[model samples]
Target: MKIAYTVAPGRGDTDLLLFGLSRCLLEKDVRATGVVQINAARDDAGPCDMDVKVLPDGPVIRISQSLGREARGCRLDPTALERAVGLVETRLAASVDCLIVNKFGKHEAEGRGFRTAIAEALSADIPVLVGLNRLNAEAFHKFSGGLATELPPNIEDLACWMTSVTAAKSSTA
Candidate 1:
Protein backbone atom coordinates (compact mmCIF):
# COMPACT_ATOMS: atom_id res chain seq x y z
CA MET A 1 0.00 0.00 0.00
CA LYS A 2 3.05 2.23 -0.33
CA ILE A 3 3.05 5.07 -2.83
CA ALA A 4 5.27 7.94 -3.95
CA TYR A 5 4.08 11.30 -5.32
CA THR A 6 6.76 13.08 -7.34
CA VAL A 7 6.63 16.46 -8.99
CA ALA A 8 8.79 18.71 -11.09
CA PRO A 9 10.03 22.02 -9.77
CA GLY A 10 7.44 24.81 -9.60
CA ARG A 11 4.64 22.36 -10.29
CA GLY A 12 1.40 21.78 -8.38
CA ASP A 13 0.46 22.14 -4.74
CA THR A 14 2.12 18.96 -3.62
CA ASP A 15 1.37 19.43 0.08
CA LEU A 16 -2.25 20.21 -0.59
CA LEU A 17 -2.54 17.34 -3.02
CA LEU A 18 -1.02 14.95 -0.53
CA PHE A 19 -3.23 16.28 2.23
CA GLY A 20 -6.35 16.05 0.13
CA LEU A 21 -5.57 12.53 -1.01
CA SER A 22 -4.81 11.45 2.53
CA ARG A 23 -8.01 13.11 3.69
CA CYS A 24 -10.03 11.15 1.16
CA LEU A 25 -8.47 7.93 2.35
CA LEU A 26 -9.26 8.85 5.94
CA GLU A 27 -12.93 9.32 5.09
CA LYS A 28 -12.90 5.84 3.64
CA ASP A 29 -11.26 4.54 6.83
CA VAL A 30 -8.02 3.80 5.07
CA ARG A 31 -4.87 4.95 6.78
CA ALA A 32 -2.44 6.66 4.43
CA THR A 33 0.50 8.99 4.72
CA GLY A 34 1.09 11.87 2.33
CA VAL A 35 4.74 12.15 1.34
CA VAL A 36 5.52 15.62 0.11
CA GLN A 37 8.78 16.95 -1.27
CA ILE A 38 11.11 17.90 1.49
CA ASN A 39 11.20 21.65 2.28
CA ALA A 40 7.84 22.49 0.76
CA ALA A 41 5.76 24.78 2.91
CA ARG A 42 2.32 23.59 3.98
CA ASP A 43 -0.58 24.62 6.16
CA ASP A 44 -1.81 21.07 6.65
CA ALA A 45 -2.78 21.74 10.26
CA GLY A 46 -6.38 22.10 9.21
CA PRO A 47 -9.26 19.62 8.91
CA CYS A 48 -7.29 16.84 7.24
CA ASP A 49 -6.44 13.93 9.51
CA MET A 50 -3.54 12.05 7.97
CA ASP A 51 0.18 11.62 8.37
CA VAL A 52 2.56 13.87 6.42
CA LYS A 53 6.25 13.09 5.95
CA VAL A 54 8.11 15.94 4.30
CA LEU A 55 11.52 15.16 2.88
CA PRO A 56 13.73 17.74 4.57
CA ASP A 57 16.22 18.20 1.74
CA GLY A 58 14.72 16.45 -1.22
CA PRO A 59 15.48 19.06 -3.84
CA VAL A 60 19.17 19.26 -3.09
CA ILE A 61 19.55 15.51 -3.06
CA ARG A 62 17.48 15.20 -6.21
CA ILE A 63 19.88 17.48 -8.06
CA SER A 64 22.96 15.82 -6.71
CA GLN A 65 21.73 12.36 -7.58
CA SER A 66 20.56 13.36 -11.03
CA LEU A 67 23.93 14.79 -11.84
CA GLY A 68 25.57 11.65 -10.54
CA ARG A 69 23.44 9.36 -12.67
CA GLU A 70 23.97 11.52 -15.73
CA ALA A 71 27.67 11.47 -15.15
CA ARG A 72 27.72 7.69 -15.08
CA GLY A 73 29.45 6.22 -18.21
CA CYS A 74 30.90 9.66 -18.72
CA ARG A 75 34.29 10.99 -17.67
CA LEU A 76 32.82 12.58 -14.51
CA ASP A 77 32.75 10.83 -11.16
CA PRO A 78 29.30 9.42 -10.38
CA THR A 79 29.91 7.89 -6.97
CA ALA A 80 28.58 10.87 -5.05
CA LEU A 81 25.44 11.03 -7.17
CA GLU A 82 24.84 7.34 -6.69
CA ARG A 83 25.08 7.75 -2.93
CA ALA A 84 22.71 10.70 -3.06
CA VAL A 85 20.07 8.76 -4.95
CA GLY A 86 20.43 5.77 -2.68
CA LEU A 87 19.98 8.04 0.32
CA VAL A 88 16.84 9.58 -1.12
CA GLU A 89 15.32 6.18 -1.92
CA THR A 90 16.24 4.84 1.47
CA ARG A 91 14.75 7.83 3.24
CA LEU A 92 11.61 7.72 1.10
CA ALA A 93 11.06 4.03 1.86
CA ALA A 94 11.65 4.55 5.53
CA SER A 95 9.04 7.28 5.83
CA VAL A 96 6.12 6.53 3.53
CA ASP A 97 3.95 3.64 2.31
CA CYS A 98 3.80 4.78 -1.33
CA LEU A 99 4.88 7.52 -3.72
CA ILE A 100 2.56 9.88 -5.55
CA VAL A 101 3.80 11.69 -8.66
CA ASN A 102 2.42 15.14 -7.92
CA LYS A 103 4.04 16.96 -10.81
CA PHE A 104 2.23 15.98 -14.00
CA GLY A 105 1.37 19.59 -14.69
CA LYS A 106 2.28 21.75 -17.68
CA HIS A 107 5.92 21.73 -18.72
CA GLU A 108 6.79 19.40 -15.87
CA ALA A 109 8.33 16.74 -18.05
CA GLU A 110 11.07 19.19 -18.96
CA GLY A 111 12.68 19.00 -15.56
CA ARG A 112 15.72 16.79 -15.17
CA GLY A 113 15.44 16.60 -11.38
CA PHE A 114 11.85 15.46 -11.43
CA ARG A 115 12.36 13.04 -14.28
CA THR A 116 15.33 11.35 -12.63
CA ALA A 117 13.49 10.91 -9.36
CA ILE A 118 10.53 9.35 -11.16
CA ALA A 119 12.88 6.88 -12.81
CA GLU A 120 14.36 5.95 -9.47
CA ALA A 121 10.96 5.55 -7.86
CA LEU A 122 9.84 3.22 -10.60
CA SER A 123 13.00 1.17 -10.32
CA ALA A 124 12.32 0.87 -6.59
CA ASP A 125 8.87 -0.58 -7.38
CA ILE A 126 7.12 2.35 -5.74
CA PRO A 127 3.62 2.87 -7.12
CA VAL A 128 3.35 6.30 -8.73
CA LEU A 129 0.00 8.07 -9.04
CA VAL A 130 0.35 11.15 -11.19
CA GLY A 131 -1.90 14.04 -10.30
CA LEU A 132 -2.79 16.37 -13.13
CA ASN A 133 -3.94 19.98 -13.16
CA ARG A 134 -6.52 21.74 -15.34
CA LEU A 135 -3.99 24.15 -16.73
CA ASN A 136 -2.07 21.28 -18.26
CA ALA A 137 -4.86 19.04 -19.56
CA GLU A 138 -4.17 19.82 -23.21
CA ALA A 139 -0.46 19.39 -22.82
CA PHE A 140 -0.98 16.22 -20.86
CA HIS A 141 -3.23 14.85 -23.56
CA LYS A 142 -0.56 15.61 -26.11
CA PHE A 143 2.17 13.99 -24.04
CA SER A 144 0.27 10.97 -22.81
CA GLY A 145 -1.55 10.52 -26.12
CA GLY A 146 -3.33 7.18 -26.40
CA LEU A 147 -2.18 5.97 -23.01
CA ALA A 148 -3.95 8.72 -21.08
CA THR A 149 -7.53 8.57 -19.97
CA GLU A 150 -9.59 11.54 -18.88
CA LEU A 151 -9.25 11.70 -15.13
CA PRO A 152 -11.77 13.62 -13.12
CA PRO A 153 -10.17 16.71 -11.63
CA ASN A 154 -9.29 16.50 -7.91
CA ILE A 155 -7.47 14.50 -5.31
CA GLU A 156 -10.47 12.23 -4.74
CA ASP A 157 -9.61 10.62 -8.04
CA LEU A 158 -6.78 9.01 -6.15
CA ALA A 159 -9.25 7.04 -4.06
CA CYS A 160 -10.77 5.45 -7.11
CA TRP A 161 -7.40 4.72 -8.63
CA MET A 162 -6.01 3.28 -5.41
CA THR A 163 -9.06 1.11 -4.72
CA SER A 164 -9.10 -0.42 -8.17
CA VAL A 165 -5.36 -1.03 -8.22
CA THR A 166 -5.38 -2.52 -4.75
CA ALA A 167 -8.23 -4.80 -5.69
CA ALA A 168 -6.39 -6.04 -8.74
CA LYS A 169 -3.26 -6.62 -6.70
CA SER A 170 -5.19 -8.47 -4.04
CA SER A 171 -6.88 -10.69 -6.57
CA THR A 172 -3.53 -11.62 -8.04
CA ALA A 173 -2.12 -12.29 -4.60
Candidate 2:
Protein backbone atom coordinates (compact mmCIF):
# COMPACT_ATOMS: atom_id res chain seq x y z
CA MET A 1 0.00 0.00 0.00
CA LYS A 2 1.65 3.18 -1.21
CA ILE A 3 -0.01 5.84 0.94
CA ALA A 4 1.57 9.26 1.45
CA TYR A 5 0.50 12.58 2.95
CA THR A 6 1.93 16.08 3.23
CA VAL A 7 1.31 19.24 5.22
CA ALA A 8 1.90 22.79 4.04
CA PRO A 9 2.48 25.75 6.37
CA GLY A 10 0.35 28.33 4.56
CA ARG A 11 -3.39 28.22 4.16
CA GLY A 12 -4.45 26.74 0.79
CA ASP A 13 -0.83 25.95 -0.06
CA THR A 14 -1.46 22.22 0.03
CA ASP A 15 -4.56 22.52 -2.11
CA LEU A 16 -2.65 24.44 -4.77
CA LEU A 17 0.22 22.00 -4.52
CA LEU A 18 -2.01 18.98 -5.19
CA PHE A 19 -3.78 20.74 -8.03
CA GLY A 20 -0.45 21.41 -9.73
CA LEU A 21 0.79 17.93 -8.95
CA SER A 22 -2.28 16.32 -10.51
CA ARG A 23 -1.93 18.41 -13.64
CA CYS A 24 1.71 17.46 -13.95
CA LEU A 25 0.88 13.78 -13.54
CA LEU A 26 -1.75 14.04 -16.25
CA GLU A 27 0.79 15.70 -18.52
CA LYS A 28 3.00 12.69 -17.96
CA ASP A 29 0.06 10.41 -18.90
CA VAL A 30 -0.53 9.03 -15.46
CA ARG A 31 -4.11 8.20 -14.51
CA ALA A 32 -4.37 10.47 -11.44
CA THR A 33 -7.86 10.38 -10.00
CA GLY A 34 -9.77 11.97 -7.10
CA VAL A 35 -10.28 15.67 -6.16
CA VAL A 36 -8.23 18.81 -5.52
CA GLN A 37 -9.72 21.94 -3.99
CA ILE A 38 -9.71 25.32 -5.74
CA ASN A 39 -10.31 28.32 -3.52
CA ALA A 40 -11.81 31.52 -4.84
CA ALA A 41 -11.59 34.74 -2.89
CA ARG A 42 -14.81 36.46 -1.87
CA ASP A 43 -15.46 40.00 -3.01
CA ASP A 44 -16.60 40.91 0.49
CA ALA A 45 -13.18 39.86 1.84
CA GLY A 46 -14.74 37.08 3.80
CA PRO A 47 -13.29 33.59 3.67
CA CYS A 48 -12.59 32.22 0.23
CA ASP A 49 -15.12 29.94 -1.38
CA MET A 50 -13.96 26.32 -1.66
CA ASP A 51 -14.65 24.04 -4.59
CA VAL A 52 -13.34 20.57 -5.35
CA LYS A 53 -12.76 19.47 -8.91
CA VAL A 54 -12.95 15.78 -9.76
CA LEU A 55 -9.59 14.99 -11.23
CA PRO A 56 -8.48 14.10 -14.82
CA ASP A 57 -11.66 15.78 -16.12
CA GLY A 58 -14.00 17.63 -13.81
CA PRO A 59 -17.38 18.60 -12.58
CA VAL A 60 -16.33 21.20 -10.06
CA ILE A 61 -18.51 21.34 -6.96
CA ARG A 62 -18.62 24.05 -4.31
CA ILE A 63 -17.96 22.63 -0.88
CA SER A 64 -18.02 25.87 1.08
CA GLN A 65 -21.12 27.79 2.19
CA SER A 66 -21.61 31.51 2.63
CA LEU A 67 -22.08 31.84 6.33
CA GLY A 68 -22.91 35.36 7.50
CA ARG A 69 -19.93 37.73 7.40
CA GLU A 70 -19.92 37.95 11.18
CA ALA A 71 -20.07 34.16 11.61
CA ARG A 72 -16.83 32.54 12.68
CA GLY A 73 -17.14 28.81 12.30
CA CYS A 74 -16.53 26.22 9.68
CA ARG A 75 -18.27 27.10 6.41
CA LEU A 76 -18.10 23.59 4.96
CA ASP A 77 -21.27 22.44 3.24
CA PRO A 78 -21.51 18.81 4.21
CA THR A 79 -23.92 17.91 1.41
CA ALA A 80 -21.76 19.52 -1.24
CA LEU A 81 -18.68 17.86 0.14
CA GLU A 82 -20.43 14.50 0.06
CA ARG A 83 -21.43 15.14 -3.50
CA ALA A 84 -17.78 15.71 -4.38
CA VAL A 85 -16.87 12.54 -2.53
CA GLY A 86 -19.44 10.58 -4.52
CA LEU A 87 -17.92 11.83 -7.73
CA VAL A 88 -14.46 10.86 -6.57
CA GLU A 89 -15.64 7.42 -5.54
CA THR A 90 -16.99 6.84 -9.02
CA ARG A 91 -13.65 7.81 -10.51
CA LEU A 92 -11.81 5.64 -8.03
CA ALA A 93 -13.76 2.59 -9.15
CA ALA A 94 -12.06 2.85 -12.50
CA SER A 95 -8.38 2.13 -13.14
CA VAL A 96 -6.28 4.91 -11.62
CA ASP A 97 -2.54 5.23 -11.08
CA CYS A 98 -3.00 7.42 -8.06
CA LEU A 99 -5.67 9.04 -5.91
CA ILE A 100 -5.10 12.63 -4.78
CA VAL A 101 -7.41 13.88 -2.07
CA ASN A 102 -7.23 17.59 -1.22
CA LYS A 103 -7.21 16.88 2.45
CA PHE A 104 -7.87 14.25 5.03
CA GLY A 105 -9.93 16.80 6.83
CA LYS A 106 -12.56 17.00 9.56
CA HIS A 107 -14.99 14.75 7.76
CA GLU A 108 -12.36 12.12 7.01
CA ALA A 109 -11.07 12.33 10.56
CA GLU A 110 -14.61 11.59 11.70
CA GLY A 111 -14.69 8.64 9.27
CA ARG A 112 -17.16 10.36 6.93
CA GLY A 113 -15.26 11.75 3.98
CA PHE A 114 -12.76 10.17 1.60
CA ARG A 115 -11.60 7.76 4.27
CA THR A 116 -13.21 4.75 2.65
CA ALA A 117 -12.05 5.67 -0.80
CA ILE A 118 -8.50 6.06 0.42
CA ALA A 119 -8.58 2.64 1.96
CA GLU A 120 -10.13 1.11 -1.12
CA ALA A 121 -7.36 2.53 -3.28
CA LEU A 122 -4.71 1.03 -1.05
CA SER A 123 -6.47 -2.29 -1.06
CA ALA A 124 -6.51 -2.20 -4.84
CA ASP A 125 -2.79 -1.31 -4.78
CA ILE A 126 -3.20 2.14 -6.25
CA PRO A 127 -1.00 4.88 -4.80
CA VAL A 128 -2.74 7.39 -2.51
CA LEU A 129 -1.67 10.95 -1.69
CA VAL A 130 -3.37 13.48 0.53
CA GLY A 131 -2.95 16.84 2.21
CA LEU A 132 -3.31 16.77 5.97
CA ASN A 133 -2.75 19.10 8.92
CA ARG A 134 -1.82 18.95 12.59
CA LEU A 135 -5.48 19.00 13.59
CA ASN A 136 -6.12 15.69 11.85
CA ALA A 137 -2.65 14.20 12.03
CA GLU A 138 -3.26 11.86 14.93
CA ALA A 139 -6.54 10.58 13.54
CA PHE A 140 -5.02 10.09 10.10
CA HIS A 141 -2.05 8.31 11.56
CA LYS A 142 -4.30 5.95 13.42
CA PHE A 143 -6.41 5.41 10.32
CA SER A 144 -3.34 4.48 8.30
CA GLY A 145 -2.09 2.21 11.04
CA GLY A 146 1.17 4.21 10.99
CA LEU A 147 1.93 3.24 7.39
CA ALA A 148 1.48 6.59 5.67
CA THR A 149 4.70 8.06 4.34
CA GLU A 150 5.18 11.73 5.18
CA LEU A 151 6.45 13.58 2.14
CA PRO A 152 7.96 17.03 2.36
CA PRO A 153 5.46 19.73 1.45
CA ASN A 154 6.89 20.84 -1.89
CA ILE A 155 6.12 20.20 -5.57
CA GLU A 156 9.49 18.66 -6.40
CA ASP A 157 9.33 16.20 -3.55
CA LEU A 158 5.69 15.38 -4.31
CA ALA A 159 6.38 14.89 -8.00
CA CYS A 160 9.35 12.68 -7.29
CA TRP A 161 7.36 10.57 -4.86
CA MET A 162 4.59 10.15 -7.40
CA THR A 163 7.07 9.21 -10.09
CA SER A 164 8.72 6.65 -7.88
CA VAL A 165 5.46 5.09 -6.75
CA THR A 166 3.92 5.06 -10.20
CA ALA A 167 7.08 3.59 -11.68
CA ALA A 168 7.13 0.98 -8.96
CA LYS A 169 3.52 0.10 -9.73
CA SER A 170 4.34 -0.10 -13.41
CA SER A 171 7.21 -2.48 -12.84
CA THR A 172 5.19 -4.66 -10.48
CA ALA A 173 2.36 -4.92 -12.97
- How many clashes does each candidate structure show, in the order listed? 14, 0
List per-prediction Cα lDDT, in the order shown.
0.44, 0.92
Per-residue CA lDDT of model 2 for 1-173, tens digit only, reads 79999999998999999999988888889898899999999999988999998998998999999988999999999999898888888888887889999999999999998999899899888999999989999999999999999999888899899989989999999
Query: Which candidate number maximizes TM-score?
Result: 2
Q: Give the TM-scores of the predictions, in the order they appear.
A: 0.44, 0.97
How far residue 145's Cα lies from its native spot in candidate 1, in Å, is: 6.2
Candidate 1 accuracy as lDDT: 0.44
Question: Which candidate should be chosen as best, given lDDT against the real structure?
Answer: 2
| Pairs clashing within candidate 2 | none
* Superposed model 1: Cα runs more than 4 Å off: 1-15, 26-34, 37-88, 91-97, 105-108, 120-126, 133-146
Window of ten residues with lowest summed lDDT in model 2 = 87-96
